[model samples]
Target chain A: MDLIKVGMADLAVCKAPQKLITTGLGSCVGVCLYDLEKKVGGLAHIMLPDSTQAKSVQNVAKYADTGIVATIEKLMALGVDRSRILAKIAGGAQMFNFAGTSNIMRIGERNVEAVKKQLEQLKIKLVAEDTGGNFGRTIIFDPQNGQLHIRTINQGEKTI
Target chain B: MEFENLNNLQKDALKEIGNIGAGNAATSLSTLLNKRINMAVPNIFILPFSQVVELMGGAEKPVAGGYLQVSGIAPMSMLFVLPEDSLKLFLNILIGKPMSEKIQLDEMDISVLKEITNILAGSYLTALNGFTNIEFNPSVPALAFDMAGAILGNVLQLYGEVSDYALVIESIFMEEEKEVKGHFFLLPEPGTLEIMLQKLGVVF
Candidate 1:
């Protein structure tokens, strides 16, 4: 099976028999959208929660708000119906924590919230999610089965 | 200030800064561990955020990272990383304990690593301040045992908002006898580089 790699602050769309993979997500979120009927999947590795915080709006895939929309659009362009698309998200981990840190340090939680809000706004049902912990995650989405495999150090692999 | 527009003189200046910082860090590390740590000449690169992890071997490579957020004068972040396989060796040398490969790190082990990171970061920052006469205060060091990409992502996020590329100064160090190796990364926040260059009297 072909594995399409998604880099940080990037997105990719692929059909069945191909898998979408994003690695080393820490405080960053991986938003995976899969269309059951069309057997298409799109993954976006977003770094921040909002694009409003960005100095340049050139890379939409770097923020949860814009990255989710861009991924949905890419899936729709591949003949996937908006109604048939469902979301499975992962990552957005704190990675490390300190006492009395500010809200900005909680970017992981914020990214998860922002991505969820965006998906809800699009009226897309969020099927499953493995998020909000103090660990990094590497996720692989298999469009053929609509399965998301999350891998972490020390912790065993889990399919969501 | 665009990194690509940096002239050779500017690049050399940055390299020298990295060298001096790494040299001090090495000295402190050697004293802490009671071992002679040899550091290679620091290499500086201006790369897209996506490619920063490639320097650590790959995005998915598991490693132990020490992260510190620096503020004042020139805000930035610093990272100290060691490969998973070398962690046991590092711990054994630091604490004089027989740490096996399969043994998990306990709270004490993590604390030891954090203290070492703190000392090294302090030494690095002190050297930079001495050179440029600028002040930099670092936060308490944080430790993470995760993939290189994940650890680096935290530091890169500060710059992701303003620029697609990051300026990275990497220093590789090894204890030849023990075969232990680690990498140190210094990343200045957006526009901080300009301030640093100006402090050193390097225009443009």
Candidate 2:
């Protein structure tokens, strides 16, 4: 079994019998998209909520919104029906304090919102989601079995 | 208010602080990496955020920034930035894994960096806490671009009131069989430092 590790602000895509895992989702969001028919799944771990903040959109595919859209599109290009795609989301913890009184520095919340909005825009239902808290999460997805494993500090592994 | 004069004071403070922080960070890394980790005293600097490229000293591009941010009710708040390659090496040593071709985001790296920040930041805050008695918790570290512009830009935007003085400490990490370099930037307002020193009972 080959284990592909996804880091913060990174993403990975795999077909059946392949596995994608992302760890340490603190204030970051991880989106897992799977297609039962094609047995293909893609996972993206995005640090920031939006790519517009960056100088260029070259790494738009690395941001939460654009990354999920691109990953879904890739699955579509591979002949998987968009409607048949199931999504699982995790991470987006508010791990710090903002200088301002407002919660504008809530990048984790923003990442979760952005991913959900994009998924909704694409008409994909977030079948399962683990998001927004004061803790970090580690997630694993098996494209072949469509199993999602999530782990957190002081919290053992559990499937969502 | 000469830049050199101010920078010299900032440099001394940065070295002293870096020695304490890096010493603690090294101890933590030794436990996590399961090896004896030695960190060289930091090379101090006070410069604008845009100076990263030059500071690289013709080393390499696409430098990675491993950031550990801590905020508290205290009057002082700051961040610590670790180099990407150094972090990569540190993670490799910590996990006993061979160096990968690229430092792409991976689970091992994320967890390691996050934990590293927790350890390093905790140590730093504890050290500060002793003098100030202010409690602080660090935010999970996320990877940042090593480019001076982006980091400094974020610094400006993040702490608008605190600027013009960034104490950067450049150091090397040495284990029995390995050697790597690292950086620690202490950005504090002059007033903040003055207050902290006063609190520490260090007059001058």
Candidate 3:
């Protein structure tokens, strides 16, 4: 089985029998788009919420909105229909439990919201999600079964 | 003003700043334990996100981390990480307990860990304030026992959106003998390098 690794602020597209994995996702959200019929999947590990809100950005994969769109475009180029694409997301954890008045404390929630909004904009149905909380997650998306396997240090592992 | 434009001398100034911070932290720990502890001279690296994760010993490595936001002349977010073995060593030395592998820290243990982080970060920031001759107020310290990459990635996101590279000052704490333990990281904000340099009489 081929496993394609997705780094932070990066994305990857793969087919059936291949897995897309991203590790140590704290506040950063991992957005996955899969075409079950075609057995094609793509994962985008996004750090921030919106690219348009940033002053300057060279990596579109660093933002949820842009990263999801970029992943969608790549999946489309792989002969997967946009209408057939389903979304599964994970990560966006606080990593540290702190109550600060700064925007940093809420970035995890914001990233999750931004990712869902992006999927909605692209007219893709979000099938499963594991997000929020105060822990780290490593997620693997298998295109063959269209299941996201999430592993955590304290919470153990589960398929969503 | 950016990190890339920094000359050798300017970069050295930042390393010197990191050296002072680490030294102060070591001294603080020494005072608390009533024994001498020294830290290796810190390294200043301006690396990309992937490199940062790799430097922390991969994304899923379990670690004890401290996160504090320093607000003032040289605004930055600081993270102090100690791996599992080091944390065990700290528990043994600080509390003198014969521990098992499954360490479920009670309230007392949590307090001790929090105090250790406070001493390390408080002294480090104080040295920075003295070096720059400006105020550096640190917010309330927060501690997490989690994966290194998770803690670092979350903090890096707060530093703003611009550069592909993140500046990190890494220090290794050395106790008796040559045993090296714990890591202290200072992630300065986007313009923080320029601010710190200008304060140190190095202007581009």
Q: Pick the candidate with the highest DockQ.
A: 1
Clashing pairs in 1: none
Off by over 4 Å in 2: A97-104, B1-39, B43-204
Per-model TM values vs. the true structure: 0.97, 0.52, 0.96
Full candidate order by TM-score, most accurate first: 1, 3, 2
For residues B82-174, what per-residue lDDT tens digits would candidate 3 score against the true structure? 887777777787887566785565677667877787778899888888878778888777778787778888888875477777888998887
The per-model DockQ list reads 0.77, 0.02, 0.73
- Give Cα-based local distance difference scores for all models: 0.89, 0.61, 0.85
Docking class for candidate 1 = medium
RMSD in Å for all candidates = 1.2, 12.0, 1.6
Candidate 3's docking class is: medium
Candidates in descending lDDT order:
1, 3, 2
Chain B TM-score of candidate number 2: 0.73
Error of 2 at B146 (Å): 23
How far out, in Å, is residue B4 in model 2?
Answer: 25
**Model 1 C-alpha lDDT per residue in residues A29-103, reported as the tens digit of each score:** 999999888889999999998899776788999999999999988998998888899999998888777765866
Per-residue C-alpha lDDT of model 1 across residues B1-204, encoded as one tens digit per residue: 887678889999999999999999999988877789999999989998899999998989988998888989799899999987778888887787686656577899899989988998999999999989888999998898888888888778878888888999999888857578889999988788999999889997
Q: In TM-score terms, which candidate is top? A: 1
Better of 1 and 3 by TM-score: 1
Candidate 2, B1-204: lDDT as tens digits: 223354455456646766776677678767776777777777666654325324543212334455555555543333444455565676666776567765564676666665665676677667667656756666666544333323333332333223323444555557766555555555554455565555555555
